[model samples]
Target: MNDNSSRPLRLGTRRSKLAMAQSGQVAQAVQQLTGRPVELVEITTYGDVSRESLAQIGGTGVFVSALRDALLAGEIDFAVHSLKDLPTKQPEDLALAAIPPREDPRDVLVARDGLTFETLPEGSRIGTGSPRRMAQLNAWARELGKEIETVPIRGNIDTRIGFVTKGELDAVVLAAAGLSRIGRSAEVSQFLEPDAVLPAPGQGALAIECAMTNAPLAATLAELDDPYTRVAVTAERSLLAALEAGCSAPVGALADLSPSPDEQIVTEMRLRGVVGTTDGKTLVQLSITGPVPSSSEEAVAMGHELAAAMLDKGAAGLMGERAL
Candidate 1:
C-alpha cells in the first residue's frame, strides 16, 4: 500500500440515483480494501441536465466529460463511470484504474402485466433510446413474425418504467445490471438473449479513473481490479475503437470467459458482436473465441481480428457513415 490510508479519498459521481448507488458500492469497497474513509462528491454532468436526446447529443460522452474534468482539475481524486458511457478514446492524462467484477450483462424487458416478448401484442410500443437496442428489437420482432413499435425515449429508470405504468408504452428495455444495482431486478419480465439482442460494449461494468500523475491513488484503485472483467471489457471496447464507432452506434458486443484447464488464472474470451441499421434491416451478427490473452495488448488484438472478420462481410457498409 502507498500509505494514503490516513487521508480520506474523494470519489466523484453523478448526482443521479443510479450513479450514487453505484458509487456508494465502490466507496465501500475502497474502505474495506485500504481501510480508508471515502467521501462522495456529487458532480452534475451534461447528460444529467440536458434535455437533448442522447443520440442527438452524440451518445453517452455527455455523461462522462464533466467527471473526467473533475478528476483532472483535482476537484476529486477519482470518478466512477458506467463503462458503456465512456468514450473509446481516453484522455492521455487519465488512467483507467480498475474494472470491478461485472454484473449480468444482458438487457431485460420491463413490461406491463409481466408480459414477455413473445406475448407482447403486435404493434406494441416499446421505449428505448439506444440505437443498438432499437435495431436488435426490430430484428427480433421480424424473427418472430411479429411487429412492434420502438419509441425513442430517455430518462432515469424510474421515469422510463413510469411510461409502462402509466400506459404510455407497453414495455421498456433496460440493462439488467442497472436494475440489479438499484435493487429493482424483480421488475424484469425477461432477459434478452445475446444471440437475439447483444448488449452495448462495456455495458454492466464500471470504470474507475484517476489522474495519471496520482500514482499512489491509481495504484490503490488498481487493487480493486478484476482481471476477468478487465479482459472481457478490453476485447469488447477494442472492437468499438477498432471499428471507429461512437458509443451510440448500432453496435453491440459482449465477451465472456470460458473454462480453462490450467489453474493459472488463464481464461479465454468468447466474444459476440452485432451490427445493424436502426430500422432492423441489414443486420449482421458474428462470434469468435480467442485463446487466453497473455496481455491486454493481446486481448485487444483478438478484438481487432474479430472486427476485421465482421467488416470483411460488409458490416462496415451496413453501418454506413453513421459510425461517427
Candidate 2:
C-alpha cells in the first residue's frame, strides 16, 4: 500500500448544500477514525448544471460520473455519494469502501400553511423530481377521492421549496433524511409513510468509495461500514438491478429486519418493491420475507426472488422496458 500517512485525504463531493453537508459529516468521521486531515473537493456534475429532468439526462449515473473520474484520476482519494443516486452496477475499478448507518428513509411534505397531504385543498399542485413519489402520491389521492396535480420539477431544496413559498405550487415532496441532515426537519408538514410510498432504493444511505487498488485506505474506511445497513440496501438495490430500472424509473424499494414469530428477537428480513407508471394508472407492488442475509449473495438472491414474483405480476410491462 502506498504511504498516505503524511498527506491529507481528498474527499470528492458534489457542490450542492446537502451534498456538502453530508460529505462534511463523513469527513469528520474519517478524520477521527484515521487521525489524518481530510479535505473536501467539490466537483460539478452534469446533473447539477443541466436544466433537463433526471430522466431526460439519463439519471442512473449523471451525478456520479464526474466524481468517479476524479477518483480514477487521483484528484481525490475517495468520494461520498448519496447511495440512491448511485448506479446499481458497481464498476470493476472502484471499491465501495463503506456504508454507514442509514437515516430515516421516508419522504416528507412541505406544504403551505402547514397543510398535510390529506388536508391540502382539492386540485393542489405537488412538486417533485421523482417519478416514484409522483406515482404513489397520485395513487393515494385517487384513493382519498381527491384531485392533485403532480408537477414535474428539478432543483435543489431551496428551488423546489421556492415554488411553494411563491405560490407557484401548493407543496413539494423531499427525502426526510435530507431535511433532517440540513437542520430543516422542523419545516416538514408530514412524513409520508413507507406503507403508502416506499422510498427509492438506498434512499437514506451514503456510499464511501475508494480505488480498489488502495487496499490500505479501503480497509481503513471499512471500519465505518455497518453490516445491517449494507445488507438491507444490497437487497433493495439488487431488486432495482433485477428490474433493469434506472434511478429515474418509477421504482421504489425498502428492506428491514422482520420480527420473529414471538415478536422478540429479529432473525428475518422483509423486502418490499414497487413499480408503477409515472401517471399512477397501474402499479405492481410485492414483498418477500426470508432470513436476514448473512452475505451479499443471499441478499441478492432474496431480491431476485421478489423481482421474479413482481415480474410475473406484470412489473416489467409497467416499466416500459425490456422483458426480463
The Cα local distance difference test for each model comes to: 0.89, 0.92
Residue runs of model 1 more than 4 Å from their true location after superposition = 1-6, 261-266, 320-324
Mark the regions of model 2 whose C-alpha exceeds 4 Å error after superposition. 259-265, 320-324
Best by lDDT: 2
Q: Could you give candidate 1's per-residue lDDT for residues 1-324 as a string of tens digits?
A: 134557788899999899999999999998887787999999999999988777788774889999998988888989999999999877899999999999999999999999999999999999998989999999889989999999999899999999999999999999999999999999999999887889999999999999999998889899999888888888999898877778888899999788767756556768888888988977878889877676788879978988898888877765532544
Error of 2 at 169 (Å): 0.7
TM-score of each: 0.95, 0.97
lDDT of 2: 0.92
